[model samples]
Target chain A: MEHPGEGTRNGGSFVVSCESVSFSYPGSGRPALSDVSFELRPGEYVGVVGPNGGGKSTLVRLLNGLLKPDSGRVLVSGRDPATEPFEVRKHLGILFQDPENGLVAPFVEDDVAFGLENLGVPRKEMRDRVAGAIRAVGLEGFERREPDTLSGGEKQRVALAGLLAVEPDILVLDEPTSMLDAAGRREVLAYLETLRAEKTVLHVTHHLEELVRSDRILVLNGGELVADKTPERFLSDADLLRENRLVLPVVQRLALEIGLSPARLRTPETLAEAILAKTESGTRAG
Target chain B: MRLELRDVRYVYAPGTPFEVEALRGVSLVVEPGEVLGIVGGTGSGKSTLVQHMNLLLTPTGGEVLVDGVDATTLKKSELRRRVGLVFQFPESALFAPTVEEDVAFAPRQLGLDEEEVQERVLESLRALEAGELAARSPFALSGGEKRRAAIAGVLAMKPEVLVLDEPTAGLDPATREDLLALILGLRNAGISVVLVSHDLDEVAEVADRVCALQEGRVRAIGTPAEVFYREPAQAPATVRVASLLRESKPEIGAPVRFAETLDALRALQGA
Candidate 1:
């Protein structure tokens, strides 16, 4: 993955920044996040991935100041989320991994309208925003339906609608598809591609294959930002990832193992090229 | 000995408007010392199929046999000793104060003596390469380490059959591979392993037999090579590789997973 925040102009900078951010929940010696740092531009789609307990979830919470960093700083929209959290939250939207956690309203439309109402938007304007959000998430007809009746995938879409209703400048999600089946995961990902066009997106997941479309990838290991590369390079770095007990996508690893040209290594595509290249070379020695 | 299922069927919300079949008329056999892979998209019954292997769920219409004994008829304690089930994120199941305690809980629960429990706990941790973590609080361990500790917990029971339900479902690439290798090692050690996953690449790497479940029914069953492309389709990579080989020479019979060498691919392509 191309390292995000690199090679961009430094002027009028980062939407979010973390300087050695470390966090520990109360009464526990272990920290959920430790010594992490990164920056995001206005509309960049960044994928955060790592082994379990590498602080992926914690990183997501830090973005919104839900859990303040115990050691360092987390700034959202150029303001410290730890201090001016209300100000920071106003500009950013976050969708947690669990849709059940976000859907507090009895009805889908009421749920979508919760955030706008909380922000003190005028009642008349809130209705318009709720309608727009529901339509955006492809749930126009289900607005009045009880959330309990929705499938896990639909519930997640409703959660996304809730975030979109806020009309924040950026969106962050944490494994929203974990509870869904394969098809559900696909729908969520497909939706994200469109959403990315309108605002910055940071999707936190451990599944590297699912992150192929992300503009940049931030890999965490032991709560540290270890490898920040473009999705292509990051997945292709088999040796480096192995040292940290991470798996690169199978296709990329097979390609590198079989001696395919590094140039042929692209997400999903590199997989085929690698296998084909090796087969033609007839060197099954590895 | 083999773990076999005979005419297994399961239903959800029975006798209600939303009643649905999760698995149906599934008959299968898994040989000891073999790694059997189960693949299917979501709601295709993959999860339901795996839950049966460990007796986590009772089949409404079938019998699960381990070593020719019906699992459904076994006592709860007996079933726990025969099959160890690991969910996707095993760490979510951890709750002990220290790694040693977590790993020992299951065996200790079985009423093993302290010496026996401690010995098995240490051996299991060593097998997972986590023996040094004895005193550390499990919550303090890293992500990968926590997963290993969970596996160790299951291993302490000395289950003859270990079932991992989507073991690497949402893990980083490196961590996924590390766990896969460990699973492969367990199978090689003569433990019957059943791996349920959607990632065809992973199933290809470790499974001796691969079965696909589609909509509460068994859709396909065979060796990885046989099922990779012969009947139901596999992942895009496996499918492409199989297609190329079949086009070059039709005699390759089916796609072979374990031997994914370049020479094999070239040979399949009539080079």
Candidate 2:
């Protein structure tokens, strides 16, 4: 029913669209999500963060069609996920924060191959895809080992290998580094950065420091979209950010709080250029 | 002393194929009024090392002495009365449906009377400022609220020492700063606190004594300033500025640990 070669793009368009969506788990009076709307084009990396459980995960699940919105519509590749759930799942790959829950194969190679095999792919083709995925995650000669034997980063790599083997156009990660130690988080995050090409990524996390590298950030508070802007613009709003529970990388926070404009947020050289660019954009808009 | 670990070592799956030694020969003591911070990259054995102080992890090769009692010999029943360990997202550890019940878990586990447990729960809720949410479903509270509820569960036990593992991991900047402020208040009341985290700057800011671990060994240990006080050879941008001018009175610029502004660094140059 599925293969790496199949695609949904008719003439190239957005991979996801969330319109006025709100969700609430069973028996919970408060809505987990509130009036949210956004469009994710292909190959765009967007980081979603908010106070813990402010509907980051719920919203991402809506993007790929994992959780249907209670009232609003969530479309995947121009199709309502609720109407075509199976088809929607085929085009997107998900990687949760915990590696233990998503991966099932005993051996590294077997685990990666598990996803491909589900599609009933030919054995030779599945083998090739598995190798390519493992190589992408930078794990060589780790095909036969059990997951427990691998280190935290390595196991995540294997889980990623499994996700990548499916050849999805978009990847959604749910705090893949939350359980890892410092070095392991760096390794996984660095690896994800390299995978940014040709794959739309929606990283759900509250770690403000981790969002600096993202192209854009969406901040949620009590199921409300409080801020939607570039990481620099988001961080520059020093007073506004204080109301939420998220923290920024220290130096960045200080730079922003000290009157550095969004454009002047990077290093001094970039800061100067950013200041210039901001003036230009502001003037152009004016 | 509130807590002490003279020499503690922990090995995971001893004598097996997965015989990975976690903590190799560690020693430290938290005085009655000290806030000790532990910092390390993942697998540096910080978690394994902290668990020993509260007897969460029985020392496999050494001794853990808490409040003059060697944890190596005390039963868990006896140890629960003295030391309390609050883990990351302790809300996940909440089994009771309601907030009030969850806070009363530890006290009830100690076989306290119902009235005493109720009183402890009330006091704990008041201390964490979640007194208003006691009857509500803990699962339904805000993220910060849930975390506070989890801490209240431990506080109800009324232990002398509190050990938290990455207490502010998923929280936003504002919530994290607020939560840490409350914990600092608890420390002021003489609760020896041991905080284990990966953020060096955070530990540098609040910890009286900071310990950095690497590859199953303690790399550096001393007062927070002594351990991370140097211009942080591998420090972030702010720390580099502070370290660059350590010779001058050094009024400011210490990365996440403190103020990171050009005012002090520039002031130093002018002076």
Candidate 3:
């Protein structure tokens, strides 16, 4: 297996691979992405994070053939995404932040079926796939509801259903829950956990808490892949996080203040449990 | 200015099949120079409620009062000038060829003289820390720069009450912190801020008071600790962690903000 931060040494069975990819927008003096490299194995839940102009979105566009890298190669399942656009799309699906951007139909059912219909799936199979997709997102009863009438969280789920119906092997989500509220964000994040076992997921987000469960976290800065580490390692390094302009979540920050390892006490439950254990032992010793 | 909504109600598409009650008897107030946070889930009428602050949407029932005067009686422009409404994605509303012209649009429409408009444009851009970007094209600026330039458009109006809808939606951690600091600084300068967002942690950090909405109705309105502590499921991460600790140690008091939570945890260690 290839090690983290060693993406230049390729030659592994990776579902997605980028070899020293560099891209720049037209008329722009600075490159949007510079010498970025990463690899994603199948069923890998990788989280991408950085500042506003840090090329997170540019990297996502490159993976789906929307933007061609100015130099180097981008391979999805061994096929170059820039040259074989259709082939790359067959194995990958992208879900942007605004669900409104992806929804094309008035009715939820029809919107979910749009991808399958475009692929020329038979009517009988399309119906089954649409139902299955809707069920996967827990929208089984809202098939006839209009997209405009749904809540922000519901609309996002419908968009995911649309992508799931296509049966793509890889799912790349770009801030899928940023527009959502606390409850809505919980809903989408919970659904993403269900996707971890079957799909190679690349989730880009500004919320560090969302990356806690990720298999690997990639930090991008000034269009460069600055750091590639697991969530625990990433959270434990205060300097690395600060260099990338990231701050720990409130719970993790509390752990740091209480002289506890922020990585192990990442979540509220675990932190609370650890605190209780420490206090109980202290009470006996004192 | 002190803004008050007494049992405000708004219905979309009234007298039609699509009619829906967006705000149902919502009542609140924005005291002068204080930061009030409005929090809710989707379809909870947070956006609709903020629209009433600037009179973008007239209440179907009940009165909106600005400093004890009925808001409806004031000229629309006068009311708009006093209560600037920064819509969600305010950057999308920046249409002028340059950032300077965009920030100047509101003041110019206020019938201010040319010199006054120019002064407000520069002052507002500086207030948002975007003075260097005044000559740049809005489309050419970075996402954070564009967001600040757009907010400058509203700031140029010199509204008494500034209502921002999800100001930090897509911003990264550092930029989000900067915006929050800017908001607090504005409140310090005597402008009442109505921060409407889904970001619970941010609300807890800056808000003097918190308001919660549910299904077009006011569910709770109090200090951040009062509202968030009462609803543990919806509390900010720090408050949630504190609540988790309280289950085992009931002596711990309610702590809403980060510093308060840290203090509470420190007290637990008896340090």
Best model number under DockQ? 3
Instruction: Report the C-alpha lDDT of model 3 over B183-270, residue by residue, as the tens digit.
Output: 9999999999999989999999999999999999999999998999898989888888889888779777898888888888889888
TM-score of each: 0.81, 0.84, 0.93
- Write candidate 2's Cα lDDT for A90-190 as tens digits: 67778865565666877899999987887878989998999999987767777876776554446667888898899877788877666565555667778
Tens-digit lDDT track of model 1 for B1-271: 5889888998876886546677879999888788888887655777677778867888899898978887767897878788888876678789999999999899998998999999999999998888898988887766567878998999889988898876664455666767788888888888888888766777877888888887778888987766766643345354544555455446544554535544454454454
Task: Name the regions of candidate 2 deviating beyond 4 angstroms.
Answer: A1-14, A64-66, A98-117, A121-162, A180-183, A243-248, A257-286, B229-237, B244-256, B260-263
TM-score-best of 1 and 2? 2
Error of 3 at A66 (Å): 2.1
Q: DockQ of each candidate's interface versus the true one?
A: 0.28, 0.35, 0.64
Ranking by lDDT: 3, 1, 2
Model 2 DockQ reads 0.35
Q: How many backbone clashes does candidate 1 have?
A: 15
lDDT of 2 by residue, B85-132 (tens): 887667777778899999998899888899999999999999877899
Model 1, span A1-286: residue lDDT tens: 2334452323554477777888887766667777887888767888887777778877877777787888988777677777787787888888876566678997899999888887989988998988988886667778777776564456778888888889888788787666555555666677778777678888887666678778788877767888777866766676756665665554454455555543246444445544556555664643
lDDT by candidate, in order shown: 0.74, 0.72, 0.87
